[model samples]
Target: MKILHLFNELKFSGAEIMYVSAAPLFQKLGCKLTVANTSLQLGEYTPAFKTAGYTIIHQYIPHALLRQWKMRKELIQLIKEGGYDVVHIHRSDLRWIMSYCAWRTRCKAVYTTHSVFRSHWYSYPLHFMQRWTAYHLFHCTFQTISDSVDANERNYYHTQTTLIYNWYGSTRFYPATKEEKKQTRLELNIPQDALVIISVGGCSHIKRHHDVIKAMPTILKKYPKAIYLHLGEGNTLEEEKVLAKSLNLNQNVRFYGNQKDVRNFLIASDIYVMPSKFEGISLTTIEAMACNIPAILYNVPGLRDFNKEKECALLIPESTEVLAKSIIELYENPKQQSTLIQNGKEFVDAYFNMEKNARKIFELYTKR
Candidate 1:
């Protein structure tokens, strides 16, 4: 089968990561795969696909209204000429437009909702339009892939949706030995004895990185050796840095803009922290768990599914004081730390195994 995957941007987001990881699996199953990324700048993962012998087509679509319309015309032309059997779209904004274009060509169109809930003010209107377009355009056989049953229901309760757990390639992100961790710390100039808390994601308000910085003072009261590493980059980086400096944590907090190899930093860290205001499902959290790093995340919908209190991780309300307390409690109790780490590794290995997830996704595509 020939498959074409569509994404709004080729950035280092969860949806883009999923496509990059799953592309090789499609090749292994003897299917031809092609990626159509609307962004002009192909992200770090684009070369990986090229190396794996998959074709990636970059469709430059400006955010301007007139330019987007032109891009849609070009997208339709590409779909017609490509002769793909399945056209799968990963982002919602592309869904309605792509579905309409696919209808013109009479191709099978499938969409996957990477985010579970809509937090934006325009989400409800966009979702309503998506549902309408799905029913009118295409073959009226629109299907969605969601991370959890709750997520599936939250987005497409009345539509056809399947729950497929998000996965991390274990080979890419795994726990390091003591020696490996020490070497990584030395390379990054991180103190070996310091309590390292690494948070990997874009510096967005939804990620609540500011909240993590707010809790830093409290965490330092107990573990003065604590250091917070903010990985990845976005618009909020400057504002967050300012906030950290104002809180007198500029020296303790390090912002590593964006690293291609995040596993090295993950291995050097003692804990992973995410105080997201909302999440569809978090790939960073799963990656940290795969590395056997216990996580301290806010009690949000998708996060709550993984970090059950007293189980694999420590879940706290979206308060800096509560997050500080959880971090201190975990740091003070070694037995609890060991248990959380062990449980986290086991849970991730069983459920978020990339191989298993790849097979399931292939099955979904091949099913009649």
Candidate 2:
């Protein structure tokens, strides 16, 4: 089977990583996998994809509507020339174009909605318009890959969508040894005695870095040696840094912008906390769980689906007081912490294995 995967950017994100991880598995199963991205720069994960023996196609086009139309025309030509069995689109903008192009080219198209929430308010109108185009103009056969039933239900009811869970890649991100943790901590200038709290996501308001900062005073009161590490980058970094300085948490808080090896950082941390206001399925949570780091996340739709309180993770209400209390409680009880960590690993291994999920997707593609 020949498959063409479409993405807007080749950035080191969950969607990009998922495609890179799954493409090799597909290739091993006697399938041809080709990747196309809007950006010429394939970002951090390009080397891994190249090493896996997959072809990368860069489609340079501006985000403007006219440019997108021309790009769609070019993409349709490519699909026709390649005679691909399937076209799978990961990003929303690309999904729209692929929907139209595939319909015109008489090719099967599949869309995976990685994120349930739009990144901006403008995206609302754009997505709604795309939905209209997909359903009416293109007569597109749509499917959604979601981590939670809430996301599934929302898409199904709102747009008559099909749903699947985003798979967790294999056990590459395991717990680090004492020596490894010590070396990583030293590199980051984190004290060995400190109770390290790591949050990995683009630094944005939706991820709620502000909420985490607000909870810190209370958390620090209990665990005086607490440290917060923010991983990844976004437009909000400077503002967050200013907020940290204002809160007098400059020493306790550190922002490691866009590290290539986040698995190392996850291994070095004592706990993984995600205070995001919204999500589809959090890859960072799965990575942390795989690393045997206990997770403390908001009891929101996507997060709550993965983390059962006192089971795999500690699910707290979306409040600074509640989050702080949970952090302190977890810090106080080492036995509970260990149990959560073990449970997290077990949960991910059982439900989120990438190879298994990719096989399911392969089956879907082969369906008549």
Candidate 3:
């Protein structure tokens, strides 16, 4: 079957990474996968998509209403001509555009809501219009990667969505050997005895990287040799670095930009923390857990869902003081750390095998 996955711009983010890991399985299912970049410029992960055996194409739609209409016509025409059976949209921004185009071409439309987000009150009209177009006109199938996203969409748009949990690459991310961990730390110049805390994702305001940095001062007071490894990069990266420098945390913090192999870093770390304001379901957090690293996440919507099934990670309120205390407490208590690690590993093993979850998605494509 021909499937076109639509994205605003491919980045080293959860959806992109997940799809890359699942590409081989999809191809094995006799699926021809194509990725369409709808943004003005093709993004950084374009090469990765190419490597994953995706047919890459640009279907740029301008921001202007008239130009968007024109481009919509072109996209619809292309979809009909190409005879794509499914247009699976991973980018929320392109939901209306892709849904309209796919529906016009009589192709099945599937959109994955990657986060629990809705616009401001002023934009409610626009949101409702898009919802009407997608649900009523296009008959698009909506998929939510987490319970939070499903609940949020139901509450806001009144749309019942299929809840498909995001899966991690189990073979790629697993517990590291003691010797491998030591070698990895040695390579990264991290002290073997130091308290290593890592958060892996793009630097953004919603990620609340600054909140973690704010907590570092208190954590340093107790564990003087504590280290923070900031992985991934974004617009707020420089700001996070500035905050780290201002707090005199240059010695304690290492800001590493987008990484190709997060497994190595995950292996080298002692703990994982994601203070994200929200998430559909954090891929990094699951990966860290699969690697047998304990996690401390904020008690926000997406992160809180992790606590629902079982206490996979230590969930604390969105406070710098609580964060610092939790980190130190988790550090000092090895037994609790082990419990969290074991629970996390069990959780991921039970629900997050990519092969199993990816087949569910492939089945969605085969649906009438």
Top-lDDT candidate index: 3
TM-score ranking, high to low: 3, 1, 2
lDDT of 1: 0.78
Cα miss at 340, model 3 (Å)?
0.6
Q: 15 in model 3: Cα distance from truth in Å?
A: 0.2
Q: Write the per-residue lDDT of candidate 2 for residues 79-131, one digit (tens) a residue.
A: 99888888887766676777888889877777776765543675666677777
Question: What is the clash tally of candidate 1?
Answer: 0
Q: What C-alpha lDDT values do all the predictions have?
A: 0.78, 0.78, 0.89
- Candidate 1 Cα deviation (angstroms), residue 288: 0.9
Stretches off by above 4 angstroms in model 2 are: 39-48, 61-72, 118-141, 147-160, 177-189, 308-310
- Which whole-number lDDT from 0 to 100 does residue 103 have in model 3? 85
Root-mean-square deviation (CA) per prediction? 2.8, 3.2, 1.4
Give me the displacement of residue 73 in model 1, in angstroms. Answer: 4.9
Q: For model 3, give the 10-residue run with minimal summed lDDT.
A: 61-70
